[model samples]
Target: MKMKPLGRTGVMVSDLCLGTMTFGTQTSETGGHRQMDMALAAGINFVDAAEMYPVNPISKETVGRTEEILGNWNASNAARRGDYVLATKHSGAGFSHARDGAPISGQTIPQAIEGSLRRLQTDYIDLYQFHWPNRGSYMFRQNWDYDPSGGDRDEVVANMQECLEALQAQVEKGNIRAFGLSNESAWGTAQWVRLADETGAPRVASVQNEYSMLCRHFDTDMAELSAHEDVGLLAFSPLAAGFLTGKYQGGSVPEGSRMSLVPEMGGRKSDRVFDAVAAYLEIADKHGLDPVHMALSWCRSRPFMTSAIFGATDEAQLQRILDGKDLELSQDVLKEINLAHRAHPMPY
Candidate 1:
């Protein structure tokens, strides 16, 4: 429940961000509200959501339901509107259910913001993020077939500039306080930063990407960019979609778990992922630590981390993670974790 600066935006955020992706799907509206209250009471001030959320099985039916839930909470909690930093995303192209399969572009920015604001029932968003780059991204298990050759540099930069202009308009209108990116690469982030600095638009304040014990892609180039560029990492799936929690370590998919619902685990299902989990679990056991706490605490230990985003289906799970919010791994434990990473790099 510690606060950190969000890039160069001067916005302060909690070290742990409560993710509401399961709000309308696995979690009921009441449950989601309770979770938010608990998170705020625990000193967590950052909450992240998206337009296309509640994704155990993302359908057209539930496309904007997550935002609506938060909106409802906001309507009732009018007095505490400014208590937390609220963030959400506009889905990129190929999200067929939203905007009829529209890609993120300057043309869509205004409309997207209007829709999100209406659904969120709020006047402004603390941080607004692009769900993905129109030029495509290597995150979400797409790294294996990642082909960056298709994007024309000029076209991509132009798009970012256009989007920045639109974002600047929103900022002027008091619609959003800061801007961010998701599922983006170091190169994509660089372009956004360059355009922002050159044009004096709202600089990219954060990048929300998948980062966990098994996924170390950000450890090198992205880490350097974050450290020097002042762009903090809003690490989604910091627990590896729950794999780092050890619930799926032995192929035991409990009934309501993400694996049981989506069996594929978003392409995270692999023998190697379990092998990686085992290695980390070993470190946790050796140090007499809860694997879930160990994984989250490990993320908290990273200097470039703005927040580690996590989701929970129920209060119990949420509290378990909250219990570990302040747990810090010792130097010895971190050394062993680094060794584990070297032993099992990119298991999925």
Candidate 2:
């Protein structure tokens, strides 16, 4: 339960963040609440959610249910509101369920924040993130075919300035304390930082992206940006959607598991992914480490990581990860991990 600074925002968050994406789906309301209690008891001080959550099967009908559940928790425990840092996201383009498929322009910022505030039963968010740029991103297994040639540089910067203006207004109105991004590239993050400095808008506090043993897209350029800029990485899917936990190994999908329900696992199911998981599992075995613990501890060991966001459907799964929250990997384990990464880079 180590705490780290969330960029230049001057807010401290736990080394591990509790992810509530499964609040209304895969996990029940009571179960989600129970997990929150356990997370807090374990000293986790950061909680992350999104408007379009419960994403095992994201549907319009259940779009905002996750935040509503969190709101309910906040309403009943009003006295504990200041005990933790709450973060949520504004969905960008390609999401048909929000604002009738509106993109995250200056026009959508206020509305999105209003909706999130209403649902969360909170006056202000500790961190508000753009889910992804309207320009699209390489996250969620889109890196292979990813193309960023859609927009002109000046036009993109202009749009960012407009969004920053809107965000500055939010900051002035006390709607959001800090700003962040998700599924962004190093260059995109730099642009946001540059614009914020130039326009007196909020500098980014974090970047929520998929970073795990199987996904090292953030290891190089993004790592450098995070190191110098102080925008620490909020790594989602630190378990690689259970692939790093070895649950989906040997083609055996456990009953009620994510892969059993959503076979594609958001395009994470592949032969290469399995092979990469095997390599990590082997390393863990060689070092007498639980693969789950190894994967999570490895994430926290990164220099640029502020927190590694993780989710679990039940308390047992949660407790197992919490038990290993303080594990410090040996130098030997890290060496094997680098070899594994070099062998299976970008398995997805």
Write one digit per residue (lDDT tens) for candidate 2, span 21-64: 99998888898888888999999999999999978889888999
Instruction: Report the lDDT tens digits of candidate 1 across residue range 1-348.
Output: 688999988889999999999999999999999999999999999999999997998998998999999999999999898999999999988888888878788889999999999999999999999999898889989999999999678887888888999999999999999999999999899889988888899999999999988888889899999998999999999899999888886669899989989998989989988988999999999999999999998987798899999999999999998888888899999999999898898887
Report the error of model 2 at residue 305, Å.
0.4
TM-score between model 2 and native: 0.98
Q: Which candidate number maximizes lDDT?
A: 2
Worst 10 residues of 2 by lDDT: 92-101
Please list the residue runs of candidate 1 whose C-alpha ends up more than 4 Å from where it truly belongs after superposition.
none
Query: Residue pairs in steric clash, candidate 1?
Result: 93-103
